[model samples]
Target: MFGELTNGRYVTLARSDLSRLLFERIKDTTEIIFGNEIVGLEEKSDGVRVRLKHGGERKFDLVVGADGLHSGVRRLAFGPQHQFEKKLGYAVAAFEVEGYRPRDEDVYLMYGRPGRMVGRFTLHRNRTLFLFVFVVDSDPLPTALKMQQEMLREKYEDGGWECPRILEELGRTDELYFDSVSQIRMNGWSKGRVALTGDAAFCVSLLAGQGSALAMISAYVLAGELLKADGRHQEAFLKYEASLRDYIQTKQQGAARFATALAPRTQLGLLFRNLVTNAFVIPGLARLVIGKEITDAVQLPDYHWQSSVI
Candidate 1:
């Protein structure tokens, strides 16, 4: 059991840490604009004219909507979010705790309750990340951070384990990132010179645990296709979609079902889940349940070298 399941191959890093590392690498080569956001886009024959919220405009040969789940670029180019966003009947609120130490510093600690989950992840020696996810039945979801915090407190106030202490700390935390668990599904990810990437195009939610990997793959394929097309965006966009759409759609389908199983809705379900994982999540069974085949559903193409990078 230990030999089959103990193979070390994956590394997990905080999203902020990864972003900061990438930004440092590209800060010198790219003209990065901070604070302002895209407000509008007008497609033309040669390029797309983009309007920022600060009354700024720029024209580019391509616009990749890597903005995220509630993407402004997706809205400007595709349409409203409701048309494409599929709510998974859950919400997650996340905050960070500085100067905290855990016994197992290298491992992720998680607990699941009926329709709720609380987890702690170590970011570094001094920093820890906390996340609280719960089932929700509300639409027109709460948008304000205060409301999200209040809702999390109200929902998990009586929760067992470390939730109470986490909630207390959450009160003092100044920054909170909250959003409904949702997947964005679109008939197509591109229109004219603009294309969507990452959470903007297809989100497998968090339950699938493949959002970041899939996004990186999307970026690589999109860039490769663009290089293959020699700056011809229409052709590149078509190829990108054709190449990855089926794989993403298959993963998205799995995510929708996995979300429910993540934090079961009933006590019996949770018990069964615990029993199954404890019994089967070992040795050859673990591989059967969750293996490389599931993780590597998409085969990445070997790309030729291109002078330009995205």
Candidate 2:
């Protein structure tokens, strides 16, 4: 299975090919409107009032709040973030770098801290993506890459292949994303007809390397539930929540554990990591720690395309 990615994300799929794949796979009549920000939601007897910015609004059979973390629709329907989100006290920012590689490098390299980890991976054919994450107190605000560069240098500057290189290249990109990795644990993700989906329902901290997968899978399930509802959006929302709750809970719990792994606090923590990494020779110990903890006793689900689902 592929690992999770955050920064400098690129997909190898060519523009036309990617568009074709998406169209063929999801050939529903679901119209996608861009740049529309949801400002408010008022539930009606049969549907929900999906109010958009600049006074545009619409009614839908179902309003799935897939807006993402800091979900605008979430607050409009439920409440503020404080009502659901629990911050783990860390944040991250990621962006691409300049000419740091051979201009043809497409492999990945990464590093980790107790509360943070960074990685890079192949996008498609020729481009490489860079990702960076760090867990810090305060906001450190570092505010910008120049500050992050200073900070990274203070911590891991001595003789690294890319620490310095990354710092130098940090100036090239103006599209950096920053946010805290907190989990959303709600007693109920649905109220009347408006329901939360994806990161709105449960944000499996990026620490678990499964945020994107969860988003994709959760959306698929939600859409399926809607189809099953046949028109009963509320029932579908509740059923979707009930069916996916256990999995979401398990994944979030795993994310908390991952946070600990990234930032080992003690000598024992370091030793424990090494032991797990080398557990093959230790009899049943591998099965005890690494297997269960890392994998969560769960295998990645296959998402092979079936002509029917689309």
Candidate 3:
């Protein structure tokens, strides 16, 4: 699937490593205030007033919510998350373990049953990442890590193919990423001097397999539009939404189909999915089947950014 889709143009790195790489590039120029949260935002005639959790207030020309799906900025600016969130009837969890045995280098191994699927991929430094996707019946999922782990164990304890061993390693790890597969939909990405970007604005969900890429694209477009607008944030926010709203909506629609494809709810659906995956071996069929999904159709504008502005 990757061979035909990516055409050898993709690299997989741990999310932490990617964050570190980006931070290194901007640390000198950017002021990063860790251990603080945005508790409130008040828009003014000229700028937005940001109230931090630590009892500090700062003003900025424009405030952007680049935060993820459960974005605090989005809530403060747009309203409650429930208003814009659309749950995709699925849940996903991922964790990595070091020195896990039975590693398949550069190969993504997957096993699926009705309503559930597990995938394993090797990473650098003898680390193995495991991803679990399954159908969910309700929302307000457990927030506690121990409860999340117990839920996964209940769902996969009787399963096959490394389930037991993976659960064993799960006990030893403290970091686990778990969340519902949901997308953010909004009529607008901005409210006054406050604007949103990345998953905070429009998340295509985890099944889309392009959240990171879309997030980067959104940030790039937002930055470029802001630069072109010359500090007029209202104009920049409108342009940013115009540039990516339709494209992001298309991706979100495609991602809705992926939830069922990843973890089919019935035996017939699972059989059909397997048949389609097996058919990928046929020459040019994979591309013909999923060409539109793999290809990015949006033409990014080349904003001639000045070095000083950057």
Candidate 4:
């Protein structure tokens, strides 16, 4: 089964079709089980035996943990996220700020030197998303919401440049996503028959704006590798890790560097950032730098997907 794109708008339907589509093309019949969480796993001569939370057991040839950020599977298979996650001393909080119109064509970027930046991006339609990220040196996440509101009032209260309008909207929205600008690093993506994909394996983090793309690419490659191994699951897992390892590492490095550039700590860093953005406003220069920067970050290989199960 396939999903049809919604008329006159883009819709996210992949989550709905994932499980059903995977089972559709499989040829040989296999037992399908659900609602059981694997609590323990052991290596056996034949394969791996997994213990379930519901007092159940199953021997599987392979296990894939594609679960996101705080992944339970990763904790079981690899170590813990905290061991690999690097905190950048920055707090990011974002919520929808309504009635803030920056442009009819594209989003607005507001930048300042003091480790603060606000970007208003137009979403699907009629609504804008406000993203504010700052560097506060200490544990800034606790009072992040309240601080953001104060910062908003102070920075934008008297501004004639779309800032006042944006502040008005920011005051109304209470919900937000708050976190440290961080990346996940894993030396290996495979352990025995257990494999990982997406954020669980390696998180590109928020600053690079490549997390979503990296996750999609990782999923596609992992699935293809599994199919290519021809039921030799260990080989498939290793191959998948080998292929994507370098790519993921490179992306993580890039994200770390980018986080620094976005919220530079030094006075020279602030001056440099402002000078660059302000000077590069010329259409030609702006296009050259911004285009090349983003493209370099997101550049990845094409993994063609085909159904071998049938």
Candidate 5:
């Protein structure tokens, strides 16, 4: 909402590498399950019985749904997907390609057209990441990755800037994360022994640039509450929801509005947006408005841990 180029401290990387790094860090402690999905959940007095699509059934004291917007756990526990999803009338896709580095590795370059925006960031030497966001009128989203790629090519093939070049690299990339830009909002994120977190429970979407961090924070609070309650999940779930609801609600609404404004519907609107953003939105102002304040939003509790080893 300003007229200037903004600067902020951000670490850019290829999404695939980021995923790999996180998995490696957690592999030792968390059993890594692949090619299986939760299809059914039965809540019992002491624990939840979970049925898997491929693996055999198992039981756990708690099931925290940290899946993305199309969460299977959320569907099984809450309801069908339609009841809680609010589409922001847009779609986004990202991939890696060769040789499109920006002059300053720290600076992210973005190009915008009416109803569409494309961003390029340097990942490392001789590698770059391309991000595409555009207005879409589809519901339930396209299921196939190939179909999503085709849609992007059709939507941006004729556009100026690096769009055409990026489209050329579509079929060559190894994988793509493509989805409709939507948020998940629910009246209640917990039921009995099961609770939801991250994009599964309350996704503010990428416009806010705070999903992953907020998700980690939610998990921290949830774990802390469980410890405080001595594993009484009912009370822990209550405290977890109460602590996170207002903060997440405010974030989700603000992000939806910001996403809408990010992509203008007409060429004139796009021009006006660019002019105002470049003319007045200074780096200092940008940091003040959207940067430092994000990390400072929540005040975490100091939990006193009792000795576990007797």
Candidate 6:
């Protein structure tokens, strides 16, 4: 349950829309590459050599893995994901359907049972986004999209309250996002000439409800540190980790506790969660319950940017 926010209002934007908006801002200034993946990274004393999936290689003074949770850069730079990934015993899936019935604008509708929940929210253009969160036993979920769909169907086969319709709609859509709700913990986020940011470094998990915000915060801080160091990556990476390590650890701890709250594993847990959620209607009760959780306590450093390039 989310409490009242006195400082800022909430705005929901589809990930595709958000990606387009960010790309539009940097398209002109940044060299955009598409359809290529990083396969190998070799760090040298002077620079890092990045090997592409398509047999291309490039060298840069430094490399930053802004990639998502399953980051290849992280694997090459640090180690395998298992060494750092901490699964929170849950999986999440989401997809969108156009012209779906019972569209509720500006509101999120959710239904829950023991160990699982489904939510739906309306988007622009007569589209509705459905999100599924459920308990999972292990990592390495099905990779194929079809398998993922079947898995969702199996998980929600006995579900009620529009779940049947949601699954029926799910069959018609091609794109579905599915992954384990896990966090990445590491002793450090950088090594040699390479550094990590966003979900690659410290994913507080989706249940934390701040993955995107924290990603942006890490990126901003990493860039600011780079600027302050005048492109001296060693100094910048150290400062970047120091500035946000404690803040991120706190967020991860909170997220680990939020898994059950997101989808209660038992009926009693669900009932208690419902009672607490309903109590939020009382004035200032939501704040009193989750005031600290909702607030962004990090004191972001103020960095001045000039026309000169780093």
Top-scoring candidate (TM-score): 3
Which rank order by TM-score, best down to worst? 3, 6, 1, 5, 2, 4
Off by over 4 Å in 3: none
Candidate 2 structure quality by residue, lDDT tens digits, 1-310: 1122112242444334755776665566556666778887777777778878865788875677877777887888889988988777666556654334655355555555444455666554454555656556674356665666566455545535456666555556666666666888899988777788878888877666666567767777777777677777778888777777887887787678766665555557756754555555555554455443344333333445355656
Question: What is the lDDT of every predicted structure here?
Answer: 0.82, 0.65, 0.88, 0.67, 0.79, 0.88
User: Model 2: number of clashes?
Assistant: 5
The Cα error of candidate 6 at residue 87, in Å, is: 0.5
Q: In model 2, where do residues sit more than 4 Å from their true spots?
A: 1-20, 23-28, 102-108, 112-122, 139-161, 265-275, 278-310
Candidate 1 vs candidate 3, TM-score winner: 3
Q: Which is the better candidate, 2 or 5, if ranked by lDDT?
A: 5
* 159-266 per-residue lDDT for model 4 (tens digits): 555666667776777876767787677778888878878877887778777665567687777777776777887787787777777767777776777777776777
Compared to the true structure, candidate 6 yields what TM-score? Answer: 0.95
Candidate number that wins on lDDT, 3 or 6: 3
- What ranking of all candidate models by lDDT puts the best one first? 3, 6, 1, 5, 4, 2
Candidate 2: Cα lDDT at 295: 48
| Candidate 6 structure quality by residue, lDDT tens digits, 23-80 | 9988978888998989998878899899999758999899999898999999988989
lDDT for predicted candidate 3 compared with the true structure: 0.88
Candidate 2, after superposition: displacement of residue 216 in Å? Answer: 2.8
Model 6 residue pairs with clashes: none
**Lowest lDDT 10-mer window, candidate 2?**
1-10
Better of 2 and 3 by lDDT: 3
TM-score of each prediction: 0.92, 0.75, 0.96, 0.71, 0.87, 0.95
| Model 1 lDDT-worst window of ten | 1-10
Q: Residue by residue across 1-310, what tens digits does model 3's lDDT show?
A: 6666667676776667878988998899989988889999988898889999986899998899889999999999989999999998899999999899899999888888899999999999898999999889977889999999999999899899899999898888799999999999999999999888888998889778887788889989999998888888889999999998888888888788878899999989999999998999997897788767766879999999888766
RMSD of each: 2.4, 5.7, 1.3, 6.9, 3.5, 1.7
**lDDT, model 4:** 0.67
Cα lDDT of candidate 1 equals 0.82
In model 2, state the lDDT of residue 30: 55
What is candidate 5's local distance difference test score? 0.79
* Model 4 steric clash pairs: none
Better of 4 and 5 by TM-score: 5
Candidate with more favorable, higher TM-score: 2 or 3: 3
